[model samples]
Target: MKLVLTQFKIELLRIFRNPYYVFWSLAMPIVFYFIFTRVISTGATDAVAWNKHYLMSMTSFSVMGSAIMTLGIRLVQERSQGWSTFMRITPLPGAIFFLGKMFGQMIMHLSSIICIFLAGYLISGVTMPVHLWIYCGLWILIASLPFLAVGTLVGCMKRVDTASGVSNALYLVMAILGGMWMPIDILPKLMQAIGKWLPSYRFGNGAWELVQGNPPKWEDILVLAGYFIVFMLISLYTRRRQEAI
Candidate 1:
């Protein structure tokens, strides 16, 4: 337990030391929240609704960025530097190392969520019951599981450069296609259909539903769980292959 805690602390320290991670996971989303909800859509009648909606969307975006892009690239870099191999040979338990990375990523994920929510409240005048706010945050965190699994899979498969490229591609594509940049109602019919099938869409949709006083559809939860399982299997396979080599 102590070793795992120590490793978790080290992992968090490493993440905080990285300027790119700090900026993307914390600063960038807040900036976007202000730009979109504050500057661009000033004096809107549905300010509260729009603020809450965009808050959820931006939280999803930031969580995806951290879970997939940041975590994936860092894992690839570690593997490329032979750090993964060194860890395998060390007395550190594999579970501890894995937990350390996961916990570190979750910390970043939570930070992003809080920052976006804060921007929504302070800048956009978003107001909600305290319990609703807590529930919405929890839902967003739950929705991040599949993306985190995907990140682990990406981390296990690609070289650093390839991982970076793939992560960026996935991040942008998912964000747009999933309607994070705009509402699905405003998108083309075909695009809306495609977005409905995406994990990102399901994630944001679930959070949006919760914020709008509706229960999240079971279908969305099932789809995310399915994706999570598939990605976990792929990650396990890749790890086994690496171990064999």
Candidate 2:
């Protein structure tokens, strides 16, 4: 238990010291929210409604960005530094090591969510039932699992530079297609069709539904679960291969 806690703290320290992670995970999303919600108004009938919608979208975006991009890059760097190899030979269990990483990522994810939510409430004047806020936040965290899994897979398989390039490309493509940056309805018909199947779209959709006082669609939940399973399988396979080598 003490070792796990120590590993978790070390991971947290590493993340906090990385200016790139701090800026992208904590600052960028909040900035985007202000630009979209305040500078460029949607002019909807209910200001709160527009803010609420963007809140969910931005939250989804932030969660995906941190879970996939940051985590993937960090994992690749650790591997390149031979940290993974060292850990493998240590007395520490693999589960505990990964769990510590997950805990650190969870902290990043929750912090991103909170910052965006605060921006929505304070700057954009978003108002909702307290329970709705809690529900939406929980859904955002839950929906991030697939992306986290994908990050782990990418980290396990790619070198640091390659992982960074791939993760960034995936992040931008998913965000654009998933209606995180803009609404899917405005996109070309083909793109909208493609967006419907991406995990990022499903994630944002679930959060949006929750904000609208509706239950999340089971299809979205199931799709994300499927993605998580597939990514986990690939990650495990990659790890096993690396161990054998």
Candidate 3:
């Protein structure tokens, strides 16, 4: 148990020390939110709904970037560099590898929440419900599992460069198509239809629902949960095959 914790601690420290991780998980979201939200208020460009809407959407978008893209790419890179291979041979438990990745992703996401809160309160002047915060936090964590599984799969399946490239492009494209960067209502009808099929879109919309005081979304949650199981199973199956090879 202590050994697992130690491994997690080491990974956490390493994640924090990496500029790419820190910037993407910490600084980049703020920059995106601050600049775009501020620009939306200028009246030259129209926004989705209002200040609160911008707050909700941008926050969700940023969370996706941190947990999905930043963490995903890094994990893939680590795997490519023989990190996972060496760790696989270590006496340290395998669960530690997954757990450490989880902690790092979660910590990075905490930075997103802080920045969003700051943007909401300071810039947008939006007030949130106590229950809503709880809802978002729980749902966000739940949604993260699929992406975590994806990160693991990408790292396990491909070379680091390939995984990193694919993960980043996937995240960015999804962010745009999912209405994380723009309003889905304004997008082409085809884009709106396609976006619905994306996990990121569902994630952003789920978060948006809570902030908008919509009814609890059991269906969406279930979809994300299902994805988590499916992704994990696939990644695990593939890893076992690789080991055999």
For each candidate, what is the lDDT? 0.86, 0.89, 0.71
Question: What ranking of all candidate models by lDDT puts the best one first?
Answer: 2, 1, 3
Score every model by TM-score: 0.95, 0.96, 0.87
What's the distance in Å from true for residue 23, model 3? 1.9
For candidate 2, write residues 1-245 as lDDT tens digits: 79988989998998778888768876787888899888986666777777888889988998899899888888898889988879989999999999999999998888788888988889878988999999999999888999999999878755788898899999999999999998888899999999999999999999989988999999899999999999999998888887796
User: What is the model-wide C-alpha lDDT for candidate 1?
Assistant: 0.86
Compare the candidates by TM-score and give the number of the best one.
Answer: 2
lDDT per residue, candidate 3, 1-245, as tens digits? 78767767887788778777657655665566677667545363434345555565676667776666666666667677777788878877777777877886777666667666676677646667678776766666667667777777766646667766777887889888878776677789999998877777777778778777885477667777787889889989988897796
Residue 83 in candidate 1, Cα distance off native in Å: 0.9
Task: Indicate the worst ten consecutive residues by lDDT in candidate 2.
Answer: 41-50
Better of 1 and 2 by TM-score: 2
Error of 2 at 107 (Å): 1.3
